[model samples]
Target: MIELKSPGEIERMAVTGQFVGGLLGELSGVAAVGVNLMDLEHHARRRIKERGAESCYWDYAPSFGNGPFRHVLCLSVNDAVLHGLPHDYVLRDGDLLSIDMAVGIDGWVADSAVSVVVGTADPADLKLIEATEVALEAGIEAGRPGNRLGDISAAIGAVARRYGYKVNGEFGGHGLGRTMHEAPHIYNDGRPGRGMKLEPGLTIAIEPWFCATTDKIKFDNDGWTIRSADGSRTAHSEHTIAITETGPRVLTRRPEPGEGAASQIKQAAANS
Candidate 1:
């Protein structure tokens, strides 16, 4: 069943989303050449401890994933696209990295992800990352009330095709709330004016992930990570949003570039 969040519940989710946004911002800034992926995991753990939040992925056991993902971070580097487990590998210049995170605050959950290139970035890598970001924005823009879920999916697909990328239909966005993943499976491509009707008080995560080559993917030996089938680089972008009577409200917005999501999470931490 599709669950609609109450006004107060949505507000609680905003706080959770804000914290996640800030966490991703901080990680992106520190991710650079010579930095070990384990270091990023430690940093995320520290922040979660300080804010008194719980990691949704740490103990998450999905059929597709290895039992109980024990890491606080998903560090997908280069060809590795989604659910990249943090190992002992150190980043190198021109390497592309995608970080996906989810945390629970006051029993509400928010999930988001971003892709970045360390040090000197390759032009192709930069373009791929930019495409995912813009596609995410387009999906969010179509998330207003009265629109169908297909509108958001079609909007994302249009952006991907314009950039000459293929969408992986296997994994995309989904409804998020008290749990990390929920009902109303969101695909990256669909026909507009179809699917479920968008209504006020619905909150969903919109993610756009694409590859430069084929839409197929292969699993890593780790049983947790997934990558492009042709070994081509991929990028992913995501955000948690709320559908309102007015419009789609972005709950995970960062206050400024590289500032992290400091506006509400910091204030909430101080109050707590």
Candidate 2:
């Protein structure tokens, strides 16, 4: 069943969202060439421990994933897209890396993801990442009150088509609060007027992940990392948003450089 959050609950979730967003931003800055993926994972674990928060991915055993995820972040590199299990791999120049994370703070949970190029970025890779980010924004904008859920899905799909990218229908977005995955399975593509009506207090994660070539995906031997079937590069962008009476409030909005409190947190993370 779909559960709407109250204002107080939403605020609590935003607290967690702030951390998730800031951490992603900081990680994006820290992910350079020669940086090991495991180092990023360690940084995330340290941050979570310091904040007294709980990792939503730790020990999370979904039916589709490998048994009991043991990491705090999902670090996908190159062709790998979702549910990326971080291992001992050093990032190389021009490698596209995707970081996905979720955490619970004070009983509320927020999830978000971002894809970035490690060092020297390839033009095609940057374009792919831009498509996902733009699609994510479009999805969030369409998640306003009274807009049908399909509107968000359709908006995301439209952006993918405009960028000439293929959308993978299997693992899109979903409701998330107090836990990682919730009800209301959100597809990447849908009819604009179809699906459940968007209402106030409704909180969901809007993610747009796309492949530069074919839409087909193949899982790695680990059973967690999802990569493009045609060995093409991919990118993913996600944000947890709440539909309010006014508009969609993005809970996991990443902090821009020089931003206030979030930037301070990013600096602290960098220093640590």
Candidate 3:
């Protein structure tokens, strides 16, 4: 069943979102050439412990994945998109890395992901990452009340087409709140004016992930990492948002370089 959040519940979610977003921002800075992927995972685990937040991925045993996920982060490298299992891999210059994370704070859950190029960035890779980011914003903008859920999907698909990227709809976004995955399966591509009508207090995660070549994806031998079928590079961007009377409030919004979590919390309160 589809569940909605009350004002107080949304506020609680915003607090969790702040932590998720802040941690992602910090991880992005820490990701550099020569750094081991395991190091990033350990850093994220430490931060989650320090903040008293619970990792949504730890011990998560989905039907498709291997027994249970034992890590705190999904570190996807070039060509690898979703559910990336971190291994003993060293970062190299020009390698595109994507970090996906979700955490629960005080019973509320927030999930977010970002893609960045380590060390020297290729122009094409940067463009691909930018397209996903722009697509994520478009999807969020379409989450306002009175719009259909497919409207968000259509908006995201349009952005992908505009950027000359093919979208894989198999593992797109979904409704997330008290848990990581909830009802209302959101596709990356769909027709507008279709699906459930948006309503206030409806919170969902809208993620746009794309590959430079084909729209097909395959799983790795580890039974978790998802990579492009054509061996093409990929990028992913996501944000958790709440549909409100005023508009769509982005709960997991990453703060600016100099911005603090207090400011983000204040902004969320003002929006509420």
Question: How many residue pairs clash in each candidate at the backbone level?
Answer: 1, 0, 0
Put down candidate 1 lDDT per residue, 53-169, tens digits, no spaces.
999989878888767899888999998899999999988999999999999999999999999999999999999999999999999999989999999999999999999998889
Off by over 4 Å in 3: 257-272
- Candidate 1 worst ten-residue window by lDDT: 261-270
Judging by TM-score against the true structure, name the best candidate: 2
How do the candidates rank by lDDT, highest first?
A: 3, 2, 1
The better candidate by lDDT, 2 or 3, is 3
Compared with the true structure, all predictions reach lDDT values of 0.89, 0.90, 0.91
lDDT of each residue in 1-272, candidate 2, tens digit only: 89999999999999999999998888887777877788788878888999999999999988877689999999999899999999999889999999999999988999999999988989999999999999999999899887898999999999999999878899899998978899899999888989999999999999999989999999998889999999999999999999999999999988763345335444554675
Q: What is the RMSD of candidate 3?
A: 6.3
Using lDDT as the measure, name the better of candidate 1 and candidate 2. Answer: 2
